[model samples]
Target: MATAAPTPNRTPPALRRKRRKELATAVGFLSPWLIGFCVFFAYPLISTVYFSLTHYDGFNPPSYVGFKNYDYVVTKFPFFWQAVRNTAWLVAVMVTLRTVFGIGIGLLITKIKTGAGFFRTAFYLPYLAPPVAATIAFAFLLNPGTGPVNHLLGQLGLPQPGWFNDPNWSKPSLVLLGLWGIGDLMVIFMAALLDVPTEQYEAASLDGASPFQKFRFVTLPNIRPIIMFAVITGIIQTLQYYTQAIIAGQVASGVVGNSGQQFEPGFPDGSTWTVPQLVYNIGFQRFDYGSACVVSILLFVVAMACTALLMRRRAGLMGED
Candidate 1:
């Protein structure tokens, strides 16, 4: 007996309604992020790009000037090269130091037996601290005199090094300070270390390999991707560094703009004005919106080029495998 023409297979209305409901629910969950991206990132990105090609005073309509802004940054602007040099120094050195320090810390902490948990939390605390508060703390910590760091050195009969005060050491001091809040990097490295199999270590030991040999061959290869990840992200983070440099820059000049006097060049003898800060000063402080837009577009191109080169290099390396 043929089963009554088994009902032509189709989704029931109830199931169709449920699927639609699920999609709607998923979209609802993403609504906040979607709204934020559209309003903040998407809009601002388009607007800034448009503004960069124009001469816009906040009060006036933006006037298009073709590549004049970019030309000015590349050709006429003196501080443009200075800002590039400073930003490159910070990004290159800090990214390198952060990667090395984070990996070293992760390895050492893992080596500990009984106190790893406590030390991990303690070391990671800086990353959790509000950036402004942490920077202020660093400011006090690096004060040439009266600060605890300097006071302790004096107790040891050593000269208190100028950290934030002397322009000569300010960039280096900032790089060192950057290491303090590198818990995020350390944590990422720690996870990669954990992914390494104990059996692989045992096997390497069986071959009578030294600890460094095992690390060099097995551990390093295993963790290369993680290290590359850190490098890319570190580049992005350090390139975006502003709060520290801005504070440091403003302090260096020790001058504020007024009706009577022009604002000084940069912080602490103009040693710490990274590209973004330079753009801000030119645009707002100097009232040369045209130069600011040029500086900004150049900065955008530099950042993009740096990121693309890094990512493309990585892609090539991966493809070779």
Candidate 2:
């Protein structure tokens, strides 16, 4: 048997040209993002680590402080510990609410066929509002005496608890405020709900499954990955919460006026001081960038550790979901 010589019917020139064009197009498409990542994100992250290690204010040249900043932060500074405590509390309370209630609301809204769009939009409004505006609005609403909430309490014959204005309730108020903007998380949960195979629900219904049972057996399993994502991002987001508390703290405690009213107020009653606010006070107001960097690093570690722990927990729960 003589095999004929293989014919050289290679790729047509037109096809080769098209492939080349596609390669060029793909490269062109990705270049902008690649360039942006290097210049903006990569550079700043590297610079931050450098800045963390040395004593550098924006104005002066950085001085090498070795591990002094980290040491002082961990061992010496009570304020650092206080800020960490405050941040931890915020993370603990706010993340829990954001997860539990936010997901519950998501499931409720999804299960409601009528007015689903309206409820979704309404629930999402807070997350869309500007942080400063939202914070200020909350401050006014939560005013201890004159706020409408207190007025409502009075109308109901209830003693009005001080909200943002009280030392006891200010941190709690911030936690509650954190709950207002879980619209994004809710949306994610809604999508995960939608991903639950319709057939599964039909089966569950035939098995006499109640709504809670359906959710437990069908919905929760389908949404486990997303739930994990929500948990991770929720913790990270709460850990990085700066704007609302910043505004609240600014409004409540005087920022620059400790000596004869020269400063802005932070949480009015000395409550709701978060890690970032404390970092700002130390690094900028007190001109201690080294200490600020130390606090920043500590917060970074805690946030990362918290996120990792949650991820591990989720992994273990993966079988259940």
Candidate 3:
């Protein structure tokens, strides 16, 4: 065989041409997404990373500062830690409450025998409201003075705590607003609950499992994946929570639009300053794009880490299943 000089294995010209054409077709189909990803996502991410290392205002050329931005954000920024705390509270308390309320509503809806469609529609309508409008409406409704809710509380001889205006109640007000718009999560949970095998429930029932036992052992296990999904998404959403919090703060502070003055975010003693709001304030308001990018990078990292952790835990749970 060595003496004979082994011939090279090669495709026929026709086959080669066909393969090339197939590859071209595949590339053609993928080109749009590839171009979009590079232009939009990849470029922005790279720019952000670079900007985070530099001192750049929007107009001036970016000058490299070598982690000074990060240092400032970590050590010197007054509102940075407060914003992180507020965001963490939203991620922890708000997300958990939304998930619980969503699941509870979903279960209740699934158990309803009459006017199911009506109830579903009624519940979902709030989620359809524009975030800005909803925040404004909620803020007005809970206004400490001259709001209908306070008026009602006064009539009932109950303490009317300032909802959005009070520092202690501001985040809770946002949580309530979030819970009011949990129709999307409710729908997801309802679908997942319905998809669980009825046979599993029947088996648990036949085994003398009580209603709570069936729910715990059968229903929960079956819908665990969906719950994980909802929780993870809720976490991510709460991490980027900006619009509602900002609007609520502005409404409560009586600053509707640009008043030609520096609009301080996180009104009522900085109780509602979120990371995204901090980023906006830094980048646009103060023109400290570098520090803004640092905050954004931190946010991105936190969101990715939380999502990965949840996903890994979900995978482990699924393996156990």
Candidate 4:
């Protein structure tokens, strides 16, 4: 038999020491992020968990209450349930509208052979606008009395809605405002659409597939993962809907004061009130940190449940693939 190959020499101690030094250097570089995580994320999360179980206002010592806050939120807080219903409605409607419009716009853009860059920029520029600025601008444009939108609608003899002022029209106005920012999702969908294999398209064409058939059978399936990503993220975002609603509530409620001023949020009889708004009202306005923490934990649980459900669906899809 051939002589056994010489065993590899053990790593020299110097090399091992050098590796250890490099590892230390790498860790040193990561120290800031690691420290930030522990301080900001870990500490706050742990504290929230602890405080959610106790009654703690900002100034007073935390009183160990043991689920009373949660019970109160579940049973006594009337607005809490309304916030839940409103948030659920927002999540359902926003996610569906964003997905449909985002994909539709993306598909349309991809079919353009000329000035595609211009069209892409035009479509995506809205997403680049600051959220607050965009919401303020939309508030102006949708103003019930003096807005240009209603003026034009009047010229066309259409019913001019009381957008932010009227309770019935408030949520729909927010939905319309959300659609203006669908550009982000559109860009993602465009990327996914462009990534569909041309070979599949060719095969479908050879099989005499119509455009709709090709899209339904090939394009949609290929881009399903991207759509799912957009939907899940959209769901999470809708659950946390706050800034736009608050700004809309403030501006439309005819309270043109400093944004910092303590105005009742979710105006029009609390029609625009959401869970995050409720949490803010509890924590900062009422100084009920314990109840706020409880609400925060509940939101966290809902988000985690949604994420888990999506992950399970993703696992099933992957298995099928």
Model 3: per-residue Cα lDDT at residue 131: 99
Report the C-alpha lDDT of model 1 over 1-321, residue by residue, as the tens digit.
777767788999999999999999999999999999999888877777777788777678778997777787777877777777878999889999999999999998888899999989988999998876776678777778667998999999988888777878889988977999989988999999989988999999999999999999888878989998898878877776778776654433333233455554545666776888777777887766766766666666777888799889878988986
lDDT of each: 0.80, 0.78, 0.94, 0.92
- Candidate achieving higher TM-score, 3 or 4: 3
> Candidate 2 on 1-321: residue-level lDDT in tens?
999999988999999999999999998999999899999978866766677788877689999888887787778865556666777787778877888887798889978989999999999988998988888888878777678998999999998987776778888888778788878888888887777899999999999999889888888888878878877887788777788887776555435235555443245534566677767777877777877877776677778898789888887887554
Better of 1 and 2 by lDDT: 1
Query: How close is every model to the real structure, measured as TM-score?
Result: 0.82, 0.81, 0.94, 0.89
Model 3 spans > 4 angstroms off: 1-16, 257-259
In candidate 1, which residue ranges exceed 4 Å CA deviation? 1-38, 250-265
Over 4 Å off in model 2, which ranges? 1-34, 253-270, 316-321
Q: What 10-residue stretch in candidate 4 is worst by lDDT?
A: 253-262
Query: 124 in model 4: Cα distance from truth in Å?
Result: 1.0
> Can you write out model 4's per-residue Cα lDDT over 64-174, one digit (the tens) per residue?
999999999989987898889889989998889989999999999999999989989998999899888898899999998999999999999999999988889889899
What is the descending TM-score order?
A: 3, 4, 1, 2
Off by over 4 Å in 4: 1-33, 258-261
Query: How much does each candidate deviate from the true structure in C-alpha RMSD?
Result: 6.4, 6.1, 1.9, 5.0
